[model samples]
Target: MFTSQGPSLRELAVQALSSVERGYDLLAPKFDGTPFRTPDRMLDAVEEALAQEEGSFGSGLDLCCGTGAGLGMLRRLCRDRVTGVDVSAGMLAEAARAHPEGVDLVRADALALPERLWNTYDLAVSFGAFGHFLPAERPALFGGVHRALRPGGVFAFPVGAPIPVTSPLWWAVAGFDTAMRVRNAVWRPPFVMYYRTFPFGPVRTDLERAGFTVETLPLPPFGLREDGSPRWRLLLARKPAAQYG
Candidate 1:
């Protein structure tokens, strides 16, 4: 579901065939025009939830920030500085164009953050980027986020509920993930993206192992399931103020 301004089918095909970073670089310009951009409603809900906790943070970061969709949300939530980091230079260029004033765009891989960034952020958020990481990579990704934040700092993002196996939506996502796998199998610099891989239970466990006290707050914007469980939730993981040595 892309807007008229979004990339054409051929453009999308080219992106899918390229490496994840290159693919995103190709898609960076029209990224916001696609459904891939994190919705404002989810962003607002997270801002509200984080606002309830401690005082305003000094700096914020959007890890795997892409074209900086989450940067604006961080700017609203953090009073001081807001920065976005991604591996795609093209994405950073577009982000720079959009946020010229007081926004720092860093081109860096999320998996291996620069040592200078360790424990430097007050808050961090990522939007729709987790699926790019494999399940085995969650621990390191979570650890990097943990190290990027100060003690008691937060790392948050929205996670949607899994579609029912019986639903057409399930088939759609399954088919998409399956096709992505097939494409990666046949392609070089494989596009390491999958939809159905991230699960809440394993994520929480990894977060805990990474020294974060994880919590989930339901997002009303996406509403609830038939069983009244939230269809979408914001995962807020805090690096504890003190750690047992």
Candidate 2:
């Protein structure tokens, strides 16, 4: 998927060898040209789904927003304000350049979001950034998200169905994950990205533990798998509004 516009294999290898934040910094300028950027169709599907479900939002947060891919979608979905947060300064710079007028880009770690942002957003969403977090980090990451949203606000993201053992894609991802493990083992700074680490069941549990009531809705555009399950589902986790007794 590397066009002349995209990063070459050697550049990608250099990025892979660096830390996650630094790697993303190096990849920022051409991030949108790379396959790692979320596809437009997936963004449109999510925007459409949220439009149908929540109707609208006051303020929205894009968690681990890489190069502001989903910022425009959040802008249309949220009437008041839209913010994109990521740890990489270079990615933020690219996002700012692309979305100069309407978007607010923040440089911050997703796991330890600033307290100033607590209870600030009415909706939160992330795309293709889960792999950076280990399963152990979900609690802190989710708790931060849970705290970021206003009571009754929803956090939404898409999850693909597990690849069956029979699928060649499954073997490919497995091998990729194995290679990553080996690389991290030998590397100085660990770049914690794994394709198979973010399973829905455990992630749902983590969300529940972080005080979100979670549910899933099928994203029909991606179609169904052989067993009739949706190939891609939108995971909607909502924080319960406070009660006045």
**In candidate 2, which residue ranges exceed 4 Å CA deviation?**
243-245
Q: Model 1: which residue pairs collide?
A: none
The C-alpha RMSD of each candidate to the native structure, in angstroms, is 1.6, 1.6
lDDT of all predictions: 0.86, 0.93
Report the lDDT of model 1 for residue 173. 86
Once fitted onto the true fold, the runs of candidate 1 whose alpha carbons sit more than 4 angstroms away are: 53-55
| True-vs-predicted CA distance for residue 207, candidate 2, Å | 0.4
Residue lDDT tens for model 2, 214-239: 99999999999889999999999999
Per-model clash counts, in order, read: 0, 0
**Cα TM-score per model:** 0.95, 0.98
Best by lDDT: 2
Clash count, predicted structure 2: 0
Best by TM-score: 2
